[model samples]
Target: MGVVYIGDRAVGKTHLALELTSPQGNYVRVFLANQNYQNLRANLLNLDGTTKPTQTIEKRSLNVEVRLPIGISKIAVDWIDSPGELFRRSWQSEHINEWENFKEMVGKSEGIFLIVPPYREILQPHIESENYVTQQQWCNRFNRWAEFFIYDCSQARRIVICLHKADLINCEIEQEISKLNYLPHGSPLNWLQRHNYVVNNYFQPVKSELEKINKSRSGLSVRCFITSIYYRSLLELPWIYLASYL
Candidate 1:
């Protein structure tokens, strides 16, 4: 199974990857390192508090055995992590070969992990904001991706839309959550606390595009997740979801 991570630059793809592969404990446990995923040897941070964006493509593999109702199945997962710039319209022609390679890989992959950041910051219009992505702009961009997947990537069966940076979404509740000692993986209480914030502000804006993908492909599986690097289970579950089909 091939799973690729796709998101805008500075949205913490590298940071989230590191956290999943090299977990720190507060509330979350069952580290992915114990499950076989390892951190990449790339810079995760800048001098400032922002994550350093991926500049080139990177790949990793995990071969693990998962138990299913039928029996224990051995699965090998291929992860292709790439620079966010590859998704930009202006960059494609400049890096034609790389862009072609990227498209080819996605067309052949089994799953896609699409990371979306909190919309509170991105939805606010700022003419000078280099990184801010408006709702319309994001929707249009991802709609194109959806079209490509539907028409070209017939092999891609799972699309996991991860609404990352959950800590930044609801600051007040998160502060309260910070006081807690532990929270189990896939806790409904944790998701209930923040789902409305992300769903109404982030997911709703892109809902139409996502719905179109669903209607167009009967076999494709589309899932949304509210995730944070601080939460271990949130990051780990998406990989397990992708692996189940394999």
Candidate 2:
């Protein structure tokens, strides 16, 4: 089995990959940083803060792979972790090259794990110009790439979308409540109503966007899951789902 991470930069792709590898008892880990040949060579020489500190905490980096053990079966998982900030102007060349490499890896992949933050939509700019692309366009491009890979692979693989940082939403709600309380005549009911609107109108759209992307694709099985490292119960969903495939 193969696993690939697809998303914009700093979205916890690498972190999630490490978590999966750490739990699987018999797995040989490999790093495939989204750096040039020269940079990757240097990265090997500088192994500071690379390995996981404990079983609970997972490390995040550019790219990594792990070989899984399947008794009497020749089963293995090659995880391809790409850079999160793919469209940065300074790293455009590296981004394109890494994406090409990602495509090649996906051709042989049996599964894909896509990670996107719930609050990212609110933070990303809605810019459109010769030099800038809207977040929606970027998302569409990402979906298209995944669609192509899923289309190419013959094995019936699982596609999981990890809605990371769900806890952050709760935190944001609390922060808003605190801010509202400073008002001379603040009302808890009013604050709750405002926060509920934000949750329904803002974060809910993310689910709709993903469902739209999945509906357009054929043959591949897709599952959306909400997760937080702090929330043990939610983390189990992805693990249980992945195990079903094995």
Which segments of model 1 are wrong by more than 4 Å? 23-51, 62-75, 121-131, 171-201
Per-residue lDDT of candidate 1, residues 1-246 (tens digit): 466666656677767766654435332222233343333433445556466556676655544343334555554545566776776778887878877887787778777777876653443243234445655676776777778767877787787787777665544535434432123344334332343344555588777777777677668867666667776655555555555564
lDDT of each: 0.60, 0.47
In candidate 2 the C-alpha lDDT for residue 231 amounts to 50
- lDDT, candidate 2, equals 0.47
Tens-digit per-residue lDDT, 21-98, candidate 2: 333323223334454444443442335634222211122333333232332222234544444344344554645665
Off by over 4 Å in 2: 17-75, 85-97, 120-156, 171-203, 206-218
lDDT for residue 221 in candidate 1, whole number 0-100? 68
Clashes of each: 0, 3
Question: Candidate 1 — worst ten consecutive residues by lDDT sum?
Answer: 25-34
Winning model by lDDT: 1
| Model 2 residue pairs with clashes | 8-84, 9-84, 9-85
